[model samples]
Target: MSDDLGFGKLLDDDGLVARLLGKTCKGRNRPLLYGPDLPVVFLTGGPGMGKGRLLRCVRDEFGRHVPAAHLDCAAPVHAERAAQHPSTRSEVTEALRELAVQFGAWSGDGGAIGVPRLYAGLVAVAAGDPLAGQAAGLDEVRRHDDLLPKGSFWGGVLHRAFRSYLAALAALFAAQPLATPLITAILDELFERVSSEGKATLEDCYGAYSGAAGHPRLGLHALSVDFQQGGEGRANAESFLFRALREDVEAAYTSVRGRMARAGRPAVLLDHADNALGRRLLRPVLLDRESGHHDRVVVIATARRADGGRFLYRSTDADAGVVTSWSPGDGGLPVWQRRQGGVPGLVAPARGALLVGMPTLTTEQQNNEVARLQGHGGHSGAAGHGARSGTSGAAGHGQGHPGPAGHQPGEHASRLRVESGIHRLSGGRPRFVTRLGEGAASLRAPDPAAFTDWDLLDAPVRSRAEPEGRPVPVADLLLDDLVTRQLPEELPPEQHDHWLDLLSHLSVAHTGACAQHLMQARQEGRDERLSAYRITELLADSGWPQCPRHFIGDRGLRHLLMRRLYRLRPDGAAWQEDHELLRAHFAARADTGDSGADEPCGTAGAHAAHHHLAAGGVEAAVDHLTGAFPLRDPSRSMARWCEELLAVAGAPCAAPLSGAPDDRHARALGEAPPAGGDWLRRRVDRLLHAVWLYEDRTRPVDQALTGTWRPLLDRLGEEPVPGTEVLTRTAGEWAQLAQERQPLKPCACTRHLG
Candidate 1:
């Protein structure tokens, strides 16, 4: 499955992993800060779009060559820690501890200097003592010790100055329960020492620590206090500590890189950048240029696109020289450049950052995925038998069957159909495809061709490892979970129902609902007092799209919500009512000059027609059909509209136009009332008018007419109704017109007519 899905190609196509390794390769003769000098690459996409899977694949393929450490931000502990506004010291401690363990494995050191040891080593360095407590021989301590010349005059001065700062940090760490105010105070003192009066004490320390290689120097006082007073103070403190730990890790990497030449630079894969902790961690690494860690390690992270610009750019730091630099050019022309330099042509800080977006599988990939699943030994027998039966119902209980060795005759066609259905439903999402494949594998009778549109829409989840009872569709379970997740726990019960109703109404809409449409929907309900702005705000907070054209966040959730709408009212009354309200709302929009070139005529008219027909308003449907029907010329969009209209026509009426009960209509011998007859005649006449317009007005007849109009004409002929003669006459006239327009060529519609 992995090979067929092009997982390997996905990694190699851009050579991202290769480039990252090359950057950190120890033997390279380039300058200290050459070629991107970025340690972080962000993989951004929607949820379940395979970011995690891709990360795992990278680990599997490159783990032996380049040690990779993966940290899942989705874990409960991590998630809870992220939820904290100002992530606590304990939270940061826990995360650092986890990272240290992962890094140890990557370095083949096996937790030799774990988080506790590293923390103690940092304290020792700050205290200017190599052998303080348990810090002796620790790599971090050794790195710090290497920065000073033993017994030198300047080194002695710097050593005495760091003593006070180190003591404060040590005290902060030793505080048993680590109070926030105390930590803040210690950090404030450290910042003041490094950036202000203390700067004179360690004037030469920065140059000595960073080495005189022109790499940006790190300063302890560089920490910003702008975030110290807000609810975000805790998070800021954690960030400071996270940066410190990272520096320690980078220092250790510098020492290890020289010896582990074959392993290349270690890559840290931080998944779930959408989470709070991940976002906080990203700032120092991706946004802070002066940190100098980018020149030492590789950081690969994942985030959702919806997180906006937070991770897209680095903040302008005055100390980092983020202003314009002017120099004399070849012709004595002034050359202006960004202070924080990047790749040759790019000026933005993101040039040093690689952003890879997750993409859906192509058609060929989807086909390969289906074939791989069907060929599996466990599913072969059931799928083969189900294909031969040509009935989906028989395949519903697919479980155990005799295995088949190879594909039988005609199996390819069935597989193709099944692949198409799955592609349409799953949109080639890897996670959804996996779930569908598992469901198919477990089916008692799994016929690819037998799968219908409705079945595809009702996506199944993988059953538990062991059978508990009758299997239920996974979509049903997910729908309930999605609803609960979207509603606020504190919302009143009645308001909750109102929100659900609003969602159901929006589900019926073809495109995303704009604020105005939502406002009208709210007005249609009894809750006119409900503020549209407030409702939208709450929905957005619950993870729904907050853009102008708002939509439910996930496609799978959208499908499940649609199914819920269908089953909301057993008698179909609620379905009709919602559609009626939506139809009226759109019609009013059209009246208010909302219809324009941007609003394609087909989309606007076709959606209204669907709602009108579902509400048993046939006359209104016919009116909408006239607006959408491609009377002048049928393009592909118009053909699709025709298909949709045909589907609506074939569906059973939700309620009689006269509003009579079902039993009343049955007692009336199922005959059409006068109004019903008039409605049907108008619908038929509009369809015929569309045909007439195509025959008389359109030139170089569209080939799509053969597929679009012919099916409707044939369906009409099959109906034993009073308009059979008129349908026959229309078909004859269309054929004659086709012959007159292009006598030499044979028309598909003309052939179908005969």
Candidate 2:
């Protein structure tokens, strides 16, 4: 109805909302809305930042020429209705179903009809008797509609119904003059509503169709809002998507005999990516440029500048161009944040992309927005009337900096209005700036400081450049509040403790091992073992975001064990106890080390050594292993410890084997020493074997063994080494009990029978 239908007004006080509405540098560009070859514009922001409102504006402006599709990714509330009342007609559904059936039947060449075929699986589901009762109220249903009729029990099975839909839409999606690019835009709190499994499947579908570059025929954009634990879950979701894209690209090329063409690249817009889910989801994507997947996809995420590294991962370069930053000097203030890095190298890089930093509202804009809120002659919070009332000055109202009160003589330049540095407070994450600000305001904090505690803010900083500080996980804070009854007021004490134990234990070990520990602890009547069900219930109680069901996949038990094990301190005695328990439990199963536990002990040890060596030298290698396992197998452990000490050792020694000279005779300790003549690895091997050999000596020791033995023992003084005492005693006990001892002797029964 307006002169320029496409341009929409944005929420003035909220930069995040404004950005989502396409109100930045490139906001007004017609190419984004109408083009022969429209470059996909990914609109990203956090929850409640107006992504949906902006999308509606796009649709209103572009009309049929824009031809955009908006997908609500939130799980269907009335699934039955959705199934019966599809968005398109039944003819299209039939066409898709036939296409699916035909495609499945076709040979390789026949299936490549310039368009993908659809599957008919859903029709059968729709027609089945099981849903007959629910369909009774469908008398008013339109027969040919795409959506299922009302009251149909099987209404919203779209995902299951839509494998065929996507295939059928492939050709439509690719057509030019799309006005909308047959756009498939999904807006949802994806991590919260969908099961992890569903997320994974969706990712796989998108990834595969994109053919490594992206869906050549369609434009796909996803906007998701995230909350606390949701960030990690979202990260898992994104990872699945990325991995799917990677695999799909490979498969498409292979299937088409390298004939597959590059489609429009996919992009993701994340609102407020400051919490765990946001961080986990965005980190890898942000770091992807450094990881060599340059051309496949691009991800744009938002975060507050103050939350620091919570939203940043290791960038491929020190700076990836847009908004390049430089360190501040002595005064903690600088002329401008320096731009020191090159642009991120992207594959099929966005043809035209712009990164704009949103600063605080201008004086005039701020005043206008405030005026609108006040209304003409309406009651103000502080006064009954106009500007001259008993209203407080800026200080009293807690607003500050109205151009330094009175400017200096030549400093109209000072009135230029610098950024409020609000970005720094929110890590430049637009959504967070808006939300936290709003939250602060709702609480009527006189200043932002009144709403946010400095102690809490200063707790820890997790930065890529430094590794020492601990991260204050948002999950932890949420859990703490839940425990303290700061929320809901319905959480029981036992429920709170259970949740704490689950999080703590899972944090201590790998997911699989933790699950097993919980199971074992639970089976033995320790309700405190932090069972998955119990943890889930507690999380549900505490309002922590739910993980996708598929994220656990078929590995539910494994996840439980690993999470519980991870909860134990790696350096604590509990760690060893847990590891041994896991090893024993896994060993009892039909297949030990099958699936998650496959690597053999010796092989694992060797791989670790090789990994260390590859990183640098023998000492460095030794240190890594020692750090991983400090107590058990001291010989191996000490060797590793010594190696690290040696690598970082200071002073002036460039010499090899500086102190010791070899005085012992030749000793073939094991059947084969390592090829590189690695003495440390060999020493470890020899010590471990000696312990085993002594334990088994009651049976027999070959001449070959004796030859290896004398030399190794000669290196050791006879009084039983202190560190080896445990091994010696165990071996001694086994030997004393066996009673058929022999010293380097062959069996008499073997030589004379012939």
Candidate 3:
């Protein structure tokens, strides 16, 4: 939000976030437009980027203005009404029921916007075919005459149906374990009652699902069978239900936004849309929207990944699956881009799947929040640390860094230090910054200064730091919330330690193959104990982004795990040994192929170089980058070339180093001795140091590049993207932001590496 959105106010912005973070057009104004627009918006980001919180804010903010409903698709039906029928399908059905009931009650100046047709269908399903058939149906309708909607359609058929409809109907849904089949029957009868015009609308909507859509019974039957039997078809059925819901939305809004041309479109905030149920609900809607059907309702789904999962990026011959991302720093939307092997010319503005990456808390944004949270006008929101923060996953309290109590009552330098420390530590993640802020605030008691209490708050997050007590350590929170607690949810308690071990090892993995190799090596041929798919899925399910290039997506999670690995043994053998395992795998993959995977051998070679560096094989990493691509690329292989170089330079640090390279590191480096093997060895250390400088996001680009990178560039005779981008921009060839001149800083992982 442009305003000082306090901690947890994720959606207070007036389209500033969408404008800045996504490739969404101006149509995505505050309260987002719908109908012939990007009908579905997927809020995708790494975990802790505040997607769920944003969804809640949207629901709360828009419910007052329009017909809006929120449903967390990941959660199963636990409401008392559906407690007996606790299934994901039942959850979907209950949520749909709640939506219909809610919107059905909504009224405008013209009158009510009830989903009479859908209601009739639900009542019909709940009413079922009585043992006395038509006799019980008539009596049943009369019993609830006041409660039912104004309709005689169902009563006429039930004139001879009244034995014991209620008990039998409950049994029908309850006996089946899932209520899909019974619900499908209700849908069939509802469709039968639809007027000819309404049928045409549905026919057009469901036409894609069932290519030729004449028979309502046929369509409902197919959906019933598929929905009853879960999988891809289950998603198809959910998609159909959504279209059915859209028919209601259009019918509801037609009297207002359509005829009156005044009111806004309705919205449905769906959290965890990348999960099993959400994907199902969104699949057909996306397909239909892509095929040129514009529904009325605005569907906003929260996804863990910025692309909203692989369904959007799973390339096929007819369509390349990657969705467009307006990742924060990009100048404009590129013509085509994908993480790996995306077919050229297949991606464009015409594709479906409207996805937006959740923007990180920027240097300015974080500073504003701290100022706003401090409950004072004096926090100075304008005085930020830097522009974009390029953290080196350097999150550890080395020693002597003052905690919350160490500062004096009115000391200005200490205040700046606290703000800078938090910004650096959090790496601009909203959740991390917010939690750290809360913890820091907790230190205000007993004494105005932090004193010894500050160390507890400031200690670098470690695995054993346990998130407990009056004010939990940030490291303990990361360990417990990110790793320990989440383990039991996916795996059994006995396997928690094993998976934690596996996860720690994965902190060093640059790719999924690297992760799989770590899991295999740790398991030692006991295939049952480890499934590459399972472990990788575990990471994704735990809310860590599962990018193939980076096995564990979130930066802080990896740093946490890496520290734990070093401490697993006194000699740091567990940390070093894991790197050895990955080094060997990449070395093998580079020589042969990527175990039937499609990535080129060059990628394997690069990965090999990274692991080699992590295992202290610095010469190998340098040689790989030095020889891999042209030093100055006219073709500009800058993206990939820079990625590998940064990867090598940013290998897991064994020591907890933070901020700029000062005199301490200078003394540690000493001199390269001007010749032979020692020169190359010094270059190895400087190669790493240059990377740290380039990646040190807390400082201005000019300052970060000027330190070690300038010398490293001349020594290696190789240029990287940062060298050019930082220099030209610094040479006054480009417009510079006010925040760009701020001076250098440092930052992560779940846990292990030597």
Candidate 4:
């Protein structure tokens, strides 16, 4: 397996084939074999977590032994056609045709290949036999025509009906690329006529025809064409056509199963099943256990983890039979059987289903991957020796010194440091790891001596760090490819800016962005007429939200996009403006009786206050905090905010503010309270109020304030305000009270009391 990048370990340990074939292993570590019941394996993960790569590996490994077809549902052509057609039946039909074309079942005879022909090809490969040298399987039926009960008068009527239908099929095939709805109607009529006049049913004809020597190929190709042609007929035809198509597929599957069992089970791999058509197909396969078609062919599919429950509306009888299901694991990579239920206690796996959660790389695996990328040949002894020697000279020279763990200097330490950096930056996601590695390789110094600069390996393409240290341009490039470029061209141009604004606001939030919060923000925006519901709908339609809550769902994308938004305005003006908008929106909501307004020590008020302070509105910020503060109660939240404010504004102490009348204080004292009080008296009053509330002997110092409050006390010491001596005495008393209440606990502030 080369073990070059640990791809072998990932596929083998994940149980991809066993679950698809419905095999249950005795233990977690055991290898699984393909079993009798064909399962629909849904392989789901976040974007760029290697779902596609795993599918490719599966195709390459299993294609040799069985007939396996892989279809990428995310292809632009499929999406475009689905958009144009806007019918689930058409989408499924197109998907099937694409699969057939990929598996070489479609002969390009200017006719749509029927389910029977497609099955025959699949079965041929399954049984280790090549198909006979004939393009059309229809010729095999000639030898069995006499087998029909033509002697009886009823049989005679059926025979003629069958012949007429075959002739119609031939004519449709001859025309090539005709409307599927038209052909479906013709087939429907033919079946109805035979059932009424000949006392034969659609199933009866299918059985007799398929049992024939050649199982005469019916040209079902016409059923997938654009029959409605923008007419009212198309609207009504979809439901009927879809039902007929499913029936035909099921019947064909039943016919092919015996052969497939004898030859060995064949499988179909559907990639990017999170797409519209893929989701449509997933519904029946996951929900309808009674459908014989699902039990006939082994189906393997991939989708975004967030969409794992897209098809499952409610738990059903078929909820437990899924052989293997995959979703994003806790560490954000695809693992097996991690997610139990969406709503905790209410849901369970579908009947006959085995759920698998995808896994992220472990630290060791990540390190190995980095080593492989750097061409270290799997961290062997020789490589270690070379690395240490290479970095040794540079270590002493200070170009790349080893920190703390004093190992041999240069290449080894540099490699280790780079590997650690890559793991941290990429979050052990395989796609991100690969991208970062490739980017680093391209940017690596040509000379070996300069290889230890780990910063160069940070992102794939380095952008001039605007304002330095922020990876804005690199983030922009990645987001441009992953999100901006992928956004449907149909989206309004103005919506792009709105999405960016939403992203920017969420980027700085303490909790992840919630759709509900964003809607609230939009409702409080300048345009009161804008519909929050419509904006959310547009975002969903744009394929940006990874889950219902998070827009741009992939964690890597979320991080990079947030970085890009954080640095959108280099001068910080735009950031401050966005934050103010957010603060005002939440404040308006709070004032209007929003549910979260009365939340106990809630983060919303804190966030709003922070933004207000950042925008240089200290009084407004203080008002928000004070208003939200629990009455007659000490609050750690208030204290945290106070500490943050003090750090940013610097110790609010100066000779003029303390009444000593320095030039700056004289100027400040001359101005109006709204303008000058913020920098002088009011600032000191707010800081003192916060300290006084926190130091109220009734309130015990929580862990958050244990070592934290000392910083505020120290900063207060630096200020030569009028009540400095009283504040110092107050701080000493608060420290004494804390030590008496919790003797063993060491408080940093208590040391100042001594």
lDDT of each: 0.45, 0.30, 0.51, 0.43
Best by TM-score: 3
Q: List where candidate 4 sits over 4 angstroms from the true fold.
A: 1-10, 18-36, 79-89, 105-264, 291-294, 315-355, 380-418, 442-474, 485-502, 510-555, 566-572, 583-605, 612-754
Better of 1 and 2 by TM-score: 1
Of candidates 3 and 1, the better by lDDT:
3
State which candidate, 2 or 4, has the greater lDDT.
4
lDDT of 3 by residue, 612-710 (tens): 766656566666665654443343254455555655655654433222124313422444322244443455455555554334322213333334444
Segments of candidate 2 deviating more than 4 angstroms: 1-65, 78-425, 442-754
Please count the clashing residue pairs in each candidate, in the order shown.
8, 87, 43, 39
The per-residue C-alpha lDDT of model 1 at residue 738 equals 50
lDDT of 4: 0.43
Model 4: how far is 309 from its true place, Å? Answer: 3.5
lDDT ranking, high to low: 3, 1, 4, 2
For residues 161-261, could you state the per-residue lDDT of candidate 4 as single tens digits?
55665566556556664343333433454444443433323333223232333221132221122222324333222322333333433433344442343
CA RMSD per model (angstroms):
12.5, 26.4, 10.6, 13.5
